[model samples]
Target: MSCTSSSMDIVPDDTFNDFAPLSKRRRVSDCSRSCEDSSCAPLKKFWFPDGDIVLEIQTRLLKVHRRRLQCSVIFSDMLHIPQPFETDQIDGCPSVALVGDALADWEVALAWIYHHDEFLNQVVTFDILSGALRISTKYEIPGLRRWAIEELSSRWPVDVVSMRLNALPHAAEAITLAQECNVPEILPAAFYALSVQKFHASADGGRSHLVLSPNDLRRLIAGREALQDALLRIAVDPLTEPGCANNAACAHCAPRRAEYWRARLAPDPKSPWSTWLVRELDWMLRDDAFAGTLCPACFHGHMSTIKWRLGRLRGAMPGFFLL
Candidate 1:
């Protein structure tokens, strides 16, 4: 049982009845008979001892305590009902069919309930954290859901460029999973990273599979184009020189400096505009290619202008990504 981001799905809203009795509670005899006659005896031995409830999860029987299930409001209400029969009990407790999710998901959820401290201390993997998130969200367990979200969000960098650089292993998956789980805060950076990275075919045959939704796809595409245009405009704008205060310096050096920058910062047809924006901005200000030709006032003024524009660009990044 391998767990990948692709295995994460939106836990159905109706999976757990929060306001009413569980629709799938099976008879104690049926659940107990299956547990006794099947391969679940080993799991029963491990989790069922002194357990008050039998949860038939898929083909397996998971014996869990009612006190542990009470941690979730959904489960608490589901388990609050009186037992139907004392004589039909298995291990001196009732049985219920826990439907919707697979046994693996329940395993993770139950582990979080019974051994929360240990689970939190363990090195959290994507599969485990994702399972916790799905179950927590399904059962309305706020603490577990918050923990899962924090763990997942930690994998993404706050800086957009860093996210773009590290996009390969998780960004696409993060975008898909975040949307599936209804976590909007994680989408902005993930979407920005995907927009800046080179588009590639996924296992689903195209990049379309990674998009959160049609609206999100539209926003990413539009934002990327807008950012490219904005960066190109900033790179090429002749206003970078900011009319030299020293008239003689302006007359002697402005034209050549402007010409040098225009030639140097010209867009590369092969590379993304974001790559050019990130890789060339600092060099454009630092490079001494035209230093020998420009006077002090003009050079300082131009550098200040470029720096100011860069600041503006940085400030506008969140808006560009619809953050």
Candidate 2:
């Protein structure tokens, strides 16, 4: 069931809790015929804050998630009845991968503008997993972000899922994407733990490789009093501090067994809390690893702390720090 509305509300998944184990990996057999076409052209790769995402997106042909055996067989029969193409053609056609671009690309496409319509025609496949988990990494992509929103309304698995704060791959990217898309539900898993962690801050800490800036540390203190009361919160904690690996998946990372046990109580069918996950956040926080995405509330808190910190530094050195 694909959305026809320009601003389609995402597929709704009221039946499942966010904390519940995500649905299983989609099989190659489950894909649609258009998605499966070998001739589909991949989306062009674009530059973002982090590494080359979707570097090979358009190269791969897509298939529908194979829940229907009959459909698959029929599609295969149709595909085998080959049709001719221009002999000079070296490139294939476009696929849905092209749809994922700057957020503006989505507005153009969804609005059915001619250029975007051409862009959509080029797309022959749509990744059912929606790459929300992928978005949860260092930075989010708008096309992918919108896709995830729609996917959220339907039942989909957390493909390649992980919440171990420490050593969590693409954690920062995922969080950033979530925040950009205005998907607040996932915010708790993304940033709260870091809000309560220790920190060493580089100015505008988030701009560079640093995750939880010094500003972030102060914000954490406000939410969890012990962080500041413990004395030099940022100075003491290794995980939350820069130059320290926040990934807890490594043998060196401290385990959070108690948090793991506590997480089981969540995933209730009757409450919004079911969509909230903390075992991973707790473990990450306990490990002192700060996930990258800062929710609106958290972002505001960090801004406040930075303003305060800068003000304090200015008072100490009239020439060096300015308000």
Candidate 3:
């Protein structure tokens, strides 16, 4: 009966459907939104709520006696790269910046830093050259680099590509700084291929072929691996989510979704999700932090893949795995 989860609460699978029931009339998921902003408010009903939904079906409402809806339901049918789900804490974009003082030798340090952050596709800034040099790659420097990496990755993901393309005389320390502040995007084969062609132009005869060949991109995707803790699942978009209509990368959403139900249904008598969910709602309503909004079926169909992949590796892996 011990409590689990950040907040000890409990709920059952049988009751999960009660909170967000799909209306028989609409037959689609209700699009309810919530955020951290105090002034911002979630819609009382979903975009296509069965009854009195503000925005439904994009159909025209009564022009003469219209309810005079305050806001329009903007359907974001973005292409190429759209934003991620609102629940996630971080965006998948990489943040890179140049960092170096007016008087500092940043050759070796900068290159190594660049390579490290570049390889991880994380944030990097050269302005903190002194701080970067302080990070000992050889010796174990407890707080300097290790903690920063954890903190930033937990909050935001930065793009190292932004740094490589933007800065000159690569500064490793600066890149590490940005990486320390944010994680980076794990580009997929299709996206990388497109990006290479977009930026690195092709040349004929005396021209330079800057684009990455198909084989190079293949090797890149093949070599990619999951996070050490199974905490992060870096999947190439469209590969797993072929029919997905939205655009954006959400690394945390997948791996975390993979385990949410299991975590709640592990048969702990105390019941982590149900108990805390109600309690949190009660507390948040009083504190005015949040309301009925909960994560939709994002976890659906995701847990199986996470478990299956973990099972394959766990049988031969070490004990330190977070699984």
Candidate number with greatest TM-score? 1
Estimated TM-score for each candidate? 0.66, 0.25, 0.19
Task: Summarize candidate 3's per-residue lDDT along 1-323 as a digit string, tens digits.
Answer: 11111111222234223222111221113223222221223222221222222211122111110121211111111011232232111011111111111112222233333345552454544333334334322112233345344433332223222222222122222233343433232122112112222112221101212233444333322322222223222222211433333322246454543344334323234421112211121232233211112233433334333334334433322122111
Candidate 1 structure quality by residue, lDDT tens digits, 130-156: 788878877778888888888766665
Residue 132 lDDT, candidate 3, scale 0-100: 39
Model 2 — which ten-residue stretch has the worst lDDT?
Answer: 1-10
lDDT of 1 at 258: 64
lDDT for model 2, please.
0.30
| C-alpha RMSD between model 3 and the true structure | 31.1
lDDT of 2 by residue, 88-159 (tens): 111232112322333333332222222345644453222322243233221323453455554432221222
